[model samples]
Target: MWDACPIELARPQKCAISEDRDKLYMDFAAPLVSEDLTLVEADPFQLMVRNGNQTCTIKYTDPSNAILSKENACVFAVNLEQHVESDLILSPTRGCKVLANRNETNLFSLSHCEKHQPHEESHFVQIKPHNKQCHTYCPESNLTFEGVNGKCPNDVWVMPMNTNFKINDVQFNGSRISIVHQETLDHVGSMKANMHLQSSVNWISLMYEINRSQPDFKPLPPFELHDYTHYVSYSFCVVVITALSLIICIVGKKLNNLPQSD
Candidate 1:
């Protein structure tokens, strides 16, 4: 069971709802005929459209937790005459909106790099992506060459990985390394790359010398901290002498009071 949905078309083509409600049938009058495209629930909030080998994803934006219904789902109708792989087409329904495609450029690459003089240690390069968003994503597969620091090879292409999806600066080396802030995306110097190569041996030697010659700063307490060594020794001697004198006096008194044992 299906209801008529509003559809806007740039050219002449008829879109009809299927009986099963899982597919959208597109009919091109006369000689041009195409197969039905199926739409299935990919997840709770996502729908996948299958047009032979090609599949396009659609996300449900409604805030409410409603089941997949005809009101919110649509299939993208792309090229059909050549039977070329296109996004899915689904049965139409009321209150549906059509999203049209436009010409959007997605580019990512290091435009240029050079060192002015043969003996110059500093090199200037230009990094370009279609936009700042692409710059954030290009570093992952582009940015630094293979190997670390001085050991990098010249001929090797930037580390390879899957770059099929959307490109953004954060998706690239952001995880592995720091990325430029959003505010810097529009800065004039954003594309400038200044690389200065330093000698590892010299760096290590300098660090070692700095560490060895560093002055050791010890923490000192706030109080004066008098020793009191003589006071302690004298007090201990007085206690011992007093104890001996008391013992002697008690012994003498006991002897005198013995009452002539004889």
Candidate 2:
């Protein structure tokens, strides 16, 4: 019974306990807390219940930010002892610095409990682009750019696109530049699927249900414009001067060759 495992501070006002032959189930009424309540640096909530000599512990947790290596790849250092359902929420607002859930989307979710190296911080998950030299940048004028073959770090997202939150479209010269116009859901979905296939961790899945109304945004293109006006103008002037000089020489030679006429 839940009475045996008393909850501290906030007790369940309404609870139901059911039991089958080999298993037991319990349901309780409790106010839901916002996932954003937890700070990125802070440890997660751990609930402990004691029944005589035995104790049961349950943790409500989220994953920390994956560290960026010198190679510019994301290396997630995970404590193997942590065996709880965790969500690695990614957000463009938070950039690549923190993994806080404020305005975040669930990029990876882990539910299975498997014993791994205990107590030590091990390299648990690594997500990197196939080509480190290649970076994806949104050109200033357009919303659509080439997608990185693999996940690459952006200002906010570790991946090329956020799974849920849509970044604001660039407004240039009274026109909206948007990736939603150039890229389809199917294209992004296929990318996420391919990452899962190439992924080494089997317990995690790209499980975030993207809201159709607020579609995910591809990263904004970096502000870039190439103009050769100076070079072109200089070349044009040089050609004109050269042609005029040749015409003057030909005219002077013709005058010199012509016989003087009264």
Candidate 3:
């Protein structure tokens, strides 16, 4: 007799499909744990990018937020030629003038109403001493006798003199008389000495009287000379006089003795 009907076919097994689904989930989860991940905000001033072997810097005036936020971004280089213009020329009338003198040169005249201009047409006046008073004849002589006197337009009087005059030495020869005057002026102005010969002794007397009238020009304190040669000469004179007197006395004595013999 044949086997009753056929043995019930076993249901297709679902375990293999379940095992495949679980393996797919594990593979996706493994990548998430092993891969490197980073999150950072973008900076407005700087940009960074990765090159083949090194990092490059990108600088730009203004950049979009999207570009800055992108990972590995760089700034575009700018050409300055298109952005710059030529320099402008400024006129002289735009500046200021502080101090000005009128007696400097011909160009500088006394005009109070004239205003100073800057870059256009400007003139500078400088007052400089011409050393006209300094005597070039004898610098090493140290006998400077000169003074300066001038008047400004504003009625200002400038009397420049050498206050350092001193009598270093005096030589009185009939023909060539020399007197040394040493002096230093307050400012580095000019110095000069004037000498006049007078035939009339009255001029000298007048000068003496005038000098006497001025109390400030009085004679300085006397200076004593302690010369050894002078003292020696005085002692020598005294000894010579004493020796002469003794010789005369001895002669007289001899004469008296001879008379008695006669």
Candidate 4:
């Protein structure tokens, strides 16, 4: 608990919907400081999971087993084997998420996001059988509004996880820690903090993907964001109006000062 709020994190895991909609699988690295939030050292944290009737703990560590560990840090895995015919709501009795505990807020170690989010619940619908016509349906998801069928044009789900080198040594000057890195993919998706003795340890997770489409590669949108009319200047209108006003004023002044018609 860095300020009494669970520090948020991200990991690459197989986030999927259940086949019977009764349970799901979670496999990801421990939550790292969110690139979106203000960060100070990426010190590893821990978790106390309460999932279903079973319980387990996992984490990612560096190859040498150092602070803010890596190599698949903080792994939270839950497997549910319920094959039902219809879609069912996953009750806490049937299954639950592996949440984090705040008993040791001061302890720095690698842990899961459930620690940051205490009231997070997840659910998934089991894949239904294909009809005689060989047609099936997709589990309801953000990607599918009314739920799609086996004929969904988009069938790919990718989760990218990564393990960059941890800061072995840092020069702490009061509230910030100083470290350096050369050009590499690790530099992407992270925001550098300008502080002394404080640092935002960006944790990268591996990529997990599920492709439900055909083997042949195909463009989904068939267009890029720039492909559409996408130029937006919040002040463009004002600038144009100001320029027009200046021109009009200049022209009006010239007309007023011109020799009077006789």
RMSD of each: 26.2, 25.4, 42.8, 28.6
TM per candidate comes to 0.15, 0.15, 0.16, 0.17
lDDT of 1 at 177: 37
lDDT score of model 3?
0.28
Predicted candidate 4, C-alpha RMSD: 28.6
Residue-level lDDT of model 2, residues 178-213, one tens digit each, is 333442223333333233223222222222211111
Which parts of model 4 have CA positions greater than 4 angstroms off? Answer: 1-44, 47-60, 65-200, 203-262
lDDT of 1 at 239: 100
Writing each residue's lDDT as its tens digit, candidate 4 over 38-74 gives 2112322222233333222323232111111122222
| Tens digit per residue, CA lDDT, model 3, 9-116 | 223333333555654221111111111111111122222222222222223222111111112221121222222233111212222222222222121111121222
Model 2 CA lDDT for position 109: 36
- Scored by Cα lDDT, where does model 4 land? 0.29
List runs of model 3 lying over 4 Å from the truth. 1-201, 206-223, 227-230
lDDT score, candidate 2, position 34:
30
Best by lDDT: 2
Report the alpha-carbon TM-score of model 2 versus the true structure: 0.15
